[model samples]
Every structure is written in structure tokens, then in C-alpha cells.
Target: MSDAAPLRIPLRPLARILHAREKGENPDAIERENLRLRHEEMRDRARVRAEGRILVLGAVFTLAFLTIGVKMWMVAESEPAEPRTSFAGAGIVAQRGDIVDRQGRVLATNLDTYALYAHPHQMVEPERAAEELVEIFPDLDQERLLKDFTGSRRFVWIRRKISPEQRQAVHDMGEPGLLFGPREMRLYPNGAIAAHVLGGAGYGEEGVAAAEIKGTAGVERAFDDYLTDPANGGKPLELSLDLTVQAAAEEVLYGGMRLMNAKGATSILMDAHTGEIISLVSLPDFDPNDRPNPPTEGHPDDSPLFNRAVQGVYELGSTLKIFAAAQALDLGIVGTDTMVDIRGPIRWGRHTIKDFHWYGKELSVADIIIKSSNIGTARLAEGIGINLQKQFLANLGLFEATPVELSEAPSGAPLIQKNWSELTTMTVSFGHGMSISPLHLAAAYATIANDGKRVRPTLLRQTGPQDGPQVISAAAARQSQRLLRQVVTEGTASFADIDFYSIAGKTGTADKPKPTGGYYNDKTISTFASMFPAHDPQYVLIVTLDEAVETSGDEPRRTAGWTAVPVAAELVTRIGPLLGLRPEIAPVPLADITLTSN
Candidate 1:
């Protein structure tokens, strides 16, 4: 009813037309219907494609925003960059490797210190600043500093290696000319503990550009390249040293030296089998941290800088009698109980060899060792002859400088007798007419301890068994150990006997030879060379005191038995437990163990 025109087509006619189009009976009507259907299908496909593109655009936008958001979050979580320090003006930036003990304890390291330099022209109040600085550093030469400040000099070193507190103080004072630069100061945490071994580093050529430090002596000099190598990158160079044992030995030796008022002292503790040095102390030691300036007037021959253990050459007195007796026994020249006639002093040229403690007209080799009979021992060496005696000492590594890993060797060649005469053989047997370092004597003793194997002394740790040659038969060494034990149990080195440990050793008291001629009777080099748990020695020690005076004690005496022996006893007592050796309250006597001939 609402239509403008009435519905004209009948349902039957429309249905007829659609049927004809499907059947293609009416050509025009079929083409029009097919065209319309195709157009509608194309429109629907286009709409689907447009919708897919829109979805893709939305995803791209989301991903872009997400990436930006994540980057912002990461930036927020990160730390702020530090302002880079400009070391452009700094002269020196020393970065040396660290030196550590066997246990990784830092022995030597670099400290970040500062050095002060002055630009005289830039200074505001030259006089006032100098006075203030002098007050702050009392050791500074006020006169020299004042002169430097007032002078027209452009650059001058006010101080090298200033402390942090001092730097802050100077900064507070607001000194204009005083500018601080970064520096590395060589620091020794243990002070004078291993001073001789560590030596020291001193500033090399000084200038305004780069500050350099050079190793002048000791291990510092010996291992300079390794320490300063950039590839090492401050990595620790480990040494074969035990701080506790070293400290104990030093304490005992120092105490003894003080008690005896000795000029100087030297002590060494080494592994008997490996020769790895555990401790090497030379008393009157200067602090490597604060090395004393070289003397301008006199030679530093007697200074603390001298490493006496490996450097000092001396006639090692009656201790050499042990070697002489060993030579006699090892060469089948004599046995432990072989009788030696000691009727009187043995005459060889002008020198007459005499024993301080004579036993009798005839004494066995064991009794001669116990009584420290010089005449009897000399006759034993005389029977061995000059060539055999020399060869035996040579085999023990005593005819030359000891193969120790120290710079002391080149400067301290062993003073061997040039003329190996009959007189030389006799005197050398009683520990006279030749000179060697305490290290040489120690190695000889170690040979007697290590089943007759003589290992070279070493400062470096051994990763494997040290290569060495046997100097004497194991039987001879065992016999020698028994003889040495007798000397400690019943003879001159009785003072060195520690109740818990089986200590075996010999004492040497030699007159110090004068620079002008013969020997100084007043001054004696007292030495004690020993091995502990003597039956199977693990450690060997050598202690020496130069020009020691028995100034105090209930019964004061300057002999090795009185001075160096007590030091050895004290050391062995304290360090035995540290070395995992339990105390034996009741020790076995040397006489109980008999040496049967092989």
C-alpha cells in the first residue's frame, strides 16, 4: 500500500525467467545475472585483502613501539658512566707484578701513591707554601725547598711518593704550584723480613715525561724482566718461602746476635732433599721498603746490603772436620773407631795444627769428632792426601761458588787454595787455608743428610724431584750422620741439641783473617751447620755470627757452641711442630745405633 506503483511482475513469470537464466534459455537475462554475481564476488575478495593489510600495519606499529620501550628500560637499569681521569699530565704509571710467598701472601706489591711537582712561576705564595710543606713533611730539606721555590725554575720535584693523607693536606692548603700526579711505590708488607731476597726497586732516570723504576739488586734485579713484563699484568710471582718459619728463624737469630753483640749474622733454612730455600736471613738487614742510600765515602762491604749467607767467604773452622772424617771413612782410609795418634800438635811447614780440646795420645775417629780434635782430623786429611781432599770437597760442591739462585754468586766466588800443597791439605782439613760461603758449607752438610746426594740450593719451588748426583755412598752418609749426632749428643755442638728432635751438627769457630796479614784472634766467625730429625733429615740449617762478642749471659763465651748453637736449638724447637714434626720427649741416643760395615 505504501508503494508508489503497484507490483507488476508476477511470481510465476520471475521464477520462469530465473529458471531460463540458469538453463541459458534466455541469453540476455543469463549474461546480466552472471555479470552481477561475478562483480559481487570480486568486491568481497577486495574487502578481505584490505582488512588483512590493516592488521599487518597495526602489528608493525606495535613492534616498533615495543622495541623503543625495551631500549629505554635497559638504559634506565644501567649505571652512569664514570668521568674518565685524564692521566695525560702524569709522568709515571708503573704497574709491576706482585711478589707473593708460597702461601699466596703478598710480600711485595705496588701502592697507588702520588708524587708532588712544582711549577715555581705558578705559585701564589712561594715562601709561605714552602714553610707549610716543610712543616707537613719534617724530613724535607727546608733550605733546599725554599731555594727551589724562590728560584726561576719552571719545574722541580717537591717530593716523590707522598701518602694519601699528605696529598689531602696539601690540597686543603690550596697550594697552586704543587700539583700531584699518579705514582706507583714499591711496597714491602713484611718490611725487612726478606730484604736480601727481595732487594728493592729505585727510581731510574728522572724527568718531566715518564717516571721509570729499575731493579738494582736481589730478586728484583734477577727477575726484573719477568716482574715488569706487561703480559704478566700484575700477576703474582710466587716464591718458595714460608713466612712463619722465616719469622721464627729470624727472631731466634736476631735474639742470639743481640745477646752476643755480633757484628752481623746469617741463617739459612733449606729443604735437605730438594735444596728449596725456605728461609735465608742475614741480620743487620736493612728494610727493602726504606733502602739506605749508598755510602759516598767508603765501600759498602760491611753494610747490611751485603748478603752474608751467600756473599761472605770465611774459613768455616772445625765444621769442615765433618767432611774430612767423611772423606776418610768414605774412601776406606778409616772407620768410625779407627785409631788416630794425637800425641802433640801436627807440624806442617811453619803452621802447627793443634786442637782446642785434645782427647788423648790415641783416639778413635768417633772420639776425635766428639772432642773436635783438629790435629787428629788434620792427620786424617793428610792420609787422604792433597789431591783426594780437593777432589772430595770438589765433589761436595765446595771448590766453587754455590749454585744458589741469587745475585750474590757472581760477587762471591769461593776462594779455593791455588796451591794444593801438603801443608794446604793439612790446614784445610782442620777448616783453615781456604774460604767458602755459608751456603757452600750448607750444601756440603745437605749432601751428608740427603743420602749423599748434593742438590744445588734454589730459591724457586720445585714442582718435581730435583736432579742431583750422589756425592758419597748412602752407608757413608749414614755413618757421617751418626758421627755428627755424636758431636751434638756428646761433643762441641751439645748446646744445639733439642730434646724433642734428633739434631745432628758440627760447630765452627774460626779466627777472622785480618786485611793486613794473618788472622784476628779477638774476632771469630762462629757457625753451626745442622740437620734435624737427623736419622732421616727433612731440613738443613746453617747459622753464622761474624765477630760475635759474649757481652752477657751467666757464663759468657764467644764460641759457636755458646752463640750460634743456641740459636739453632731455639729455631729447631719452635719450627719442628710447624713442619709437622711431633715432639719426642725421650729421644734415641746416637750411641744406641751402631754403624756396621757394608
Candidate 2:
């Protein structure tokens, strides 16, 4: 094969020979054979070129698939991203709108927690599980828990709110019955700071998969519809309360209550201009976070659950004299200089009105307020008469429910005798026969302080100028302020006088009515109703103690000046600076001020 030489055809001769074969005409045989060889070579070259193109396309496809696979591997190896959630979706905490103070401090809010549950039917070694649980939570009754664990129930609450540690312990127990799920719990961040004002939220029906909380009392109950509505739940509810003022008032009031060995106490601080409640303290307040169950037996009426500020109605004692004097002044029946003979007790049809301390002196209208004279006040009330006194009390909101933003507020129509006897007029004038809520008295004082404007007391923050109707002439209100100032400088409420703050207030010590149908001379409701910065009159604060008893070795005095006045004074001292009040004691002029009886 190496010795034989192959012959190649020339271009023109090979082409012609191929054309002759196609026509079936015979030509040179050598050229025809060469042409056939050339044509075979060309077909082979074309086949090789087609194979090269297909191999290149396959390589490109392979590269693309390899890149895609590498990307998928990278994604799988990385940590998975968290899934987004919404309130409307399950497993998300759904709660009421937040309750915040005027400064945006959260008063009431929701806390996300785990609710422990169990499936007794699925439990294995339930005795062991109950034993372990009781070890974790000593409060859980072992016997009761053992019963729940061994029962055939599908689901049972082990605990409402459990810590992460407790949950891990339960999970580690390897018990099939133990389980935990998401829950929303209403939390009062300040604990019992404003418990009575914020109230509390209660859980929905038992055995419900989804837990819902509804407001039960106080502002929570009052604004439940707005708070629970999905559209409004995101927006916070703002209140007029100042936590600093509230804390101060509570500290002083509670101190006084305990020191006096009193039954209960209530204190209120309100803005004179807008009637916004700055602070309201009712002692023995329940913790809104964990409200106690109602007592099984005994009198529910004696329960601390009652809000003494607005829900309680009391005689309010000589505090009502402030209103009586104001009414007298407004009606032009008595001027500050007008004199009244209070040396003798005024005898009515079935009763006699006498001052607690008879000085046998004639008292002016200012002196009547300064001395808190029941006899003088009764004489003035007699002049105003029953109808005018009724109208005056009505205007002051004593004849109706306080329009405060509380659902539990009392609709206390003043406890009045329907007969409207002369004796009733005398007693009512000195805050004896008629009973009214402390809030009613506070609102009335706020009216006098706000230049005779009748303001509707509000818990919501005020945004605009209050459109309160003018209840008395500004001139008369000014005169009333002067007399009120004298009450602190030279009158009965000297103990409440903060020299720097120019405090003006009234002291009231009323005999508490016995449940057995008579007044208790030994027990009394001592109260102080006051306004600070007397000349400008910005805030009205009222402190009341139920059944205050004096233990001071000097005397067993159950009077407001001895108990409530000092409380008010201390509260003002603490909160005045917080409220931006400067203390500059300018001595009140005493040129014509006198309280001598004829």
C-alpha cells in the first residue's frame, strides 16, 4: 500500500467528467474516477462541519444549566428569611388601642406571651408531668393539675402566661400533653399607678381558639368600641392625666389615710380653665393587671372596687359652703361685707343649725366662709331660699351626675328630702342633708376658679378654648376669689395655706350617716377643697378622707383641717413645681378681714 501512488484530478477535467456521468455519456474513465473521489471528500468535510456546530451548541447549553444549578445551591445553603406577618393573620397579636397620658406615656398596652395548654387525652405519665409542673410553679395546686392531666379533654389551660424558662422546662419534660401557644395579655406598665382610671381588660369566652380582650371598667370600658375597632386600634387614646401629679397626690393622700386611720380616701386635681383632670387618686385601688375576683360573701358595697371620686356620694360637709357663699354672692343676696348673726343657732321645723365652734359673733359673708360657719351659712341659705338654692346646686352639677368620661360615674341626684322643708334648706346649705359626688364638688369649684365659666369636666386632652357658658359674672367670681383667699390667710383652712402658692380652700367635717338610721358623732368625713395660686386660680384640688380619726395625744379631732388639709398642703408642695407653679408668698392684706360674732 506504501508503494502505490494515488492520482488526483485537475479542477476543470474533474468537473467536466462529473457532468458527463450525469448526462450518461462516456468520457475519460480516469477523470471520472478522480471526480468521484473528490465528491466523496467534499461530503465528508460537510458532515464534519455540521458535527462541530452541534457540539458547540451543546457546550453553550451545558454552561447555562451549570450556572443555574450553582445559583440554586447557594440559595439553599444560606439561612432562610423570616416570613412577614400581619395583625389580620393568625399567630399575630391582636389588641386594643394603647392608652397614653397627655405626654404620650403608655398607661395601658398589650404584651405578647405564651399561654400554656395541655391535652389530657394524649398525656403519657401525667402524674410525673403534674409533679414537674408544680415544681416549676408552686402556686399550681397539685391535686387539681393532676386531675387535668389525667382527664380525657382535648385542651385545658395549664397557665395563661408563662415565661420562656417555664415553657422550656415543660417542653423538656417530654410529655405529650404539654403544649404552648401565642397569647396577647393586657399589661399596665405602671402597675397600679392609675389603676382606677385605666381600668382593666377581661378575656373572651373559654375554649375559644382565638383569645380576645374586652375593656371592663374605667376609661377602658368607656372607650371600648373605639379601642377595639381595627381601624382605630392603631391610634393611641390620649388622656389629660399627668402621672407626676397623680403619683404625688397618691403618695400624700395614702399617707394621710393611713395616718388618720381612715376607711378610704379620694383626691382629685383638675384644670380651672378646661376642666381637664390632671390627677385623680382613689386609695385601695385594684391592680388593673390582675383584678381580684369579687368576694363570695360580705357586703360588696364596702368593696374598694367602688370609685370614691365619682361613684361615691357623701354629705361633703362644710365644703358645700364655698358654693353657698358663691351662690349668695352671685344672687346679690350677700356681699363680702354683708353681716350675719351666727352667735345663736337657727331653729328650723325639726332641726337646728349651729356652728361646730360657736364664737358668739356676727360674721360677714367672707367671715362665714373663713370660719366655715354652719349657722351663718344657714342664715344665708334662708335668704337665698329653697328654689334658688336648688337652682344654684343644679347649676353647680350637684343636682345631677358628673359628666366625667367614666361609665361607673354615679348619677347622684343630691340626696334631698322631696318635701323641701325649711329644715332641709338649712341643712343643705352647710352640706348636711344633701349628698353629692366629690367630682361634682370639684367641677363646681373649677367653675368658680375659671372666672365663673361652667366647664364640662373631661379626661380627654383639651385642644381648643372651652366653650363653657358663663355661670356667674366675672366681677362676682373675683369677689369670691378674694373671700376664698381669706379662707387660707385668716379663715378655717389655714393649715392648707402654702404661703408661696397662695392656696385658697375650705375645710369640711361632716357626720357620717350610720346604716342603722342615725349620724355617727364619733366618725366623720373630713375633706379639703382648694385652689392654688388663688389670684390667678389655675387648678382645683380636693382631698377627702372617710371616717378620719385623730390619734395625736392633744385631742381626738375628726376635722378636715387636721387630716385632709395637711394632705392637700403636702401634695401641692410636691406637685406645684411639677406643674410649673412658682412659690412667692405675698402676704394677703388683712385690713378689713374679721370673724368676730355679736
Which residue pairs collide in model 1, if any?
A: none
Global CA lDDT computed for model 1: 0.84
Q: Model 1, 558-585: lDDT tens per residue?
A: 7898888988898898888877888877
Write out the backbone clash pairs for model 2.
361-597, 361-598, 362-597, 362-598
List per-prediction Cα lDDT, in the order shown: 0.84, 0.83
Native-structure RMSD, model 1: 13.5
Residue-level lDDT of model 2, residues 323-384, one tens digit each, is 77888888888789999888777766566667778767898888888888888988888888
| Model 1: how far residue 428 lies from native, Å | 0.9
Stretches of candidate 2 above 4 Å error?
A: 1-93, 206-209, 299-301, 411-414, 585-598
Q: Give the root-mean-square deviation of each candidate in angstroms.
A: 13.5, 11.9
Deviation from native of the Cα of residue 464 in model 1, angstroms: 3.4
Which 10 consecutive residues of model 1 have the lowest summed lDDT? 82-91
